[model samples]
Target: MGQKRSTFLFSALCFGMAFLYIPMLLLIIYSFNYSKIVPVWGGWSLRWYKVLFESEEVWSALTLSLKIAVMNATFATLLGTLAGLALVRFGRFKGRTLFSGMITAPLVMPEVITGLSLLLLFITMAELIGWPGERGITTITIAHITFSMAYVAVIIQSRLAGMAQDLEEAAMDLGSKPIRVLVDITLPLLAPGMVAGWLLAFTLSLDDLVIASFVTGPGANTLPILIYSRIRLGLRPDINALATIIIVVVTIGVIIAGYLMLRQQKQRERDMQMAAQEVVKLDA
Candidate 1:
């Protein structure tokens, strides 16, 4: 009976994984197909890849998306880290509940609503101040940052909340100023969380389509937008190639992040062990 149950669980796990990954596997395989039609295996060739490389529009959209993702990741990490610090470290402030709720509102809000709300805000600001001239990359980047930062904040907050505050307290007790303690100790400890948040923000910004579409103007189509526009006609081999490329890039990033996280965990364990030994020696 136990053996049967174990086999059942393993089968279920395999089935779940296959359900999620088989489509991606097929897409990757078909990316190399020489035919314009997808899933229909024509002899494997680099024809679509060659065309993808030559398409100036695709490259432009890709470039724009990369720029926005990079900017959003950096800014979101900064703002989100600060917000997380505020929530975690600053205890019992006035309007703390409201501030926390506002910061996290993006996470729960529908994408369409977030996009429309941002569009409205941008338009209002533009009319009132006569700045930002028109909507385009800047608007899209800002919109992405607005939502992506919330995710980053939640990640950082969870990290901070789970962490022990003894090190921080010790450093402060040693006559270190709060700012110095944060800069020297807190920030170093939060490095993993910050990197995770940045990567999460980057992925969110790159994956965003609805928000980007609402914020982008003429000649500012992101890669997702370009793909959306083209797919309205029909799926091209070039799109398959593009998707394959994205899958490869994302997989690489995930691998790198996992490696870094594992390395950090090992380092942290070593540090704690060393600290324990030092404390034991002091007591002796």
Candidate 2:
């Protein structure tokens, strides 16, 4: 019975992995096809990659997306960190429940609804203030920031909840001002969470389609938007090539980040062991 169960579990894991990765593998393989028609397999060639690199539209969209993602991630992380600090450290301010609900409302909201609401808000703001006269990268970045910050705030809240307050309290007791304690102790401990939050926010902004579509205007296509429009026309080899490039870049980034994290963890473990040995020697 145990052998059968183990075999079943192993099979299930393999199936799940294949289900997720098979499509991507096919896409990467097809990207090299010499044929323009996606379904027809011509001899393997780098033709699409050359076409993709030379396309000014693709490069422009990619550059715009990167700029917006960077801006959105930075703003989201800053705002989210502030909101998380307030929620976790402020100790029951008035309207805390309402504030918390508002911050997290985007997480539960439908993308269509969020997009429509933001569109309306931007239109209204334009009518009243005459600012952002046209919806483009700025509007899209703002929309992305609005939703992305909620995810960052949740991450920060969870990180704060798990962290012990002893160090912060000790800093306070040692004549550190509240600002100093926060800057020196709390923020340092929250660094990992902040980095994770920023990355998450960046990914969210980059991957956004619906919100960006609603908020964007003429000549402001993001990479996803451009890909989506092209796919609607027909599947092109260049789209596959672009996707393969993205997948490769993302995979490389993940591998590098994992390696760095492992190294840091090992160093931390060594430091802990050395501290333990020194304490033992002193006691002896």
lDDT of 2 by residue, 1-284 (tens): 99999999999999999999999999999999999889899999999999999999999999999999999999999999999999998899999999999999999999999999999999999999998899999999999999999999999999998998888899999999999999999999999999999999999999999999999999999999999999999999999999999999999999999999999999999999999999999999
lDDT of each: 0.93, 0.96
Q: Estimate each model's TM-score.
A: 0.90, 0.96
Per-residue lDDT for 29 in model 1? Answer: 88
Candidate 1, superposed: residue stretches over 4 Å from native: 263-284
Candidate 2: lDDT of 269? 100
Error of 1 at 68 (Å): 0.5
lDDT by residue for model 1 (136-189), tens: 989999999899999988999999999889899999999999999999899999
